[model samples]
Target: MKKLFLTLFLLSGLLVTASCNNDNKKDKKETETVEKETVEVKEEKVVKTPTIVGVAAANENFTTLVAAVKAAGLVETLNGDGPFTVFAPVNDAFAKLPEGTVDGLLKPESKETLTAVLTYHVVSGKFMAADVVKAISDGGGTFTITTVQGGTLTASLDGDSVILTDAKGGKSKVILTDVSASNGVIHAIDTVVMP
Candidate 1:
């Protein structure tokens, strides 16, 4: 009788231990499944929608503006963490310039001029068209914006549209308004005015 009682107790203990082990395995599996789900969510975020510097980068019209940005060694900077707003000018806009002027400026010797012109079109922080329009309507007299080049661009409201008059009195009309990008905004201009 004593031997039988010992055997029963041993068997019960073994069964309990085996059951606990199985429960632990189930718990581990559940945790692993949750971990895998979390990993999948993170992987989804890793797929980035590539944003060109601004709408200008995507715009077929702003070929001149794109070329100038490339020439000024500003592609990376514009692509960097800017909430920049660009007054992007098109190829036809550049053609409106004085004869031989665009070509002269594109040369390596005229980098300073090219850089100034390019940066003049940019506002350092992102400004949505609505905000800019509102600002223009307000009594600020001058809505001053700092450029990527550390200079200021002044905006004034003329009738319905915003008139951006650079430091040198060069003016551009905002044709395409409020194009948003990951880094900035782009406003298409009809003419490539100089600064």
Candidate 2:
């Protein structure tokens, strides 16, 4: 009787241990699966921000500006991690120039001039419309900023609009204000500002 009771007890204990081990393995697998699912969910929620070049490329009005930037070899510079302020010109702005001017600038020989003109539209730091307006107000209604092309641009308010004066006395009105980008801000102009 004692031997039979001991044998029965040992078998029951082994069976219970085996059952617990199987449950533990199942629980571990479930935990791993849940963790993987969580990681996948996090990845799916991530959002990508558009850069200055990306913003220009996406908009129809900035197609000419985008082409000019590419021709000037400034795509990488604008795509860099900078807080630049760009005064972007619309297609009509380019049309405001004399005939054949755009075609001439797009040529390889005029790369330097094209670069200078494009960089002239960019400032080193980001300046939104409100910041520009405040600067204008603080500076006796006119604000002077240095461009990346080693030229100075004057900003002043005309009614509710901001006017940009170029080095060659050309005036460009900011028709669209505060187009935000990952690396900078863009202000669309009706006329191309010359360096």
Candidate 3:
């Protein structure tokens, strides 16, 4: 009877130990899961907002523009902290240029010209679509915007669209506007405007 009692006692102790181990394993697993969730939340909150150049680089529509920006060495300038208003031209807009024009401009020898052309599309301050319309209205149907390239672009309203006339009299219609970035705004234009 004593042996039996001893055996039952040992069995109970073993069962309790096994149960405690199981409970510990469960607690450990729960802790690991909670840690993973916390890490995931931290990762979600760590995402950085894109700048103007980053926004252009991430967009498929601005491939040509991004390339031109890089080629002209204006990536840093455009990416700087400023409320710039960029009249971004889409790939289709680049294609609308004369054949071999874009290639020539992208060449290293044409960096100055390319920079000027690119900067022509950028205004010094952030001007939302409404602000531009208001400026046009306040200017009596036309607003002259001084380009970063030291040239002038005339903004006017055509029916319901905003039109930008370049220094050389090229016209580009604003197709998309108010593309917000960390440093500026982008207004997509249907044509490339020359400086």
TM-score of each model, paired residue for residue: 0.70, 0.82, 0.78
| Model 2 per-residue lDDT tens digits across residues 28-68 | 99999999999998889656779999999999999999999
Candidate 1: list runs displaced more than 4 Å.
1-49, 52-54, 140-142
What RMSD does each model have against the real structure? 4.2, 3.0, 4.2
Compared with the true structure, all predictions reach lDDT values of 0.78, 0.95, 0.95
lDDT per residue, candidate 1, 1-195, as tens digits? 999999999999999999999999999999999999999988885545344465566667877777888887888878888777788887888988899988888889888889988887777778888888777668466577777667776778777777777767787777778777878778888777555
User: In candidate 2, which residue pairs clash?
Assistant: none
Candidate 2 residues lying further than 4 Å off, grouped into runs, are 1-37
Give the distance in Å from residue 145's predicted Cα in candidate 3 to where it truly belongs: 0.5
Q: How close to the true structure is residue 183 of candidate 3, measured as C-alpha lDDT?
A: 88
Ten contiguous residues minimizing lDDT sum, candidate 1? 45-54
List model 3 lDDT by residue over 1-195, tens digit each: 999999999999999999999999999999999999998988885556688999999999999999999999998898899979999999999999999999999999999999989999999999999999999999999999999999999999999899999988899999999999988899999999997
Give me the runs in candidate 3 sitting further than 4 Å from their true place: 1-44
Judge candidate 3 at residue 20 and give its lDDT: 100
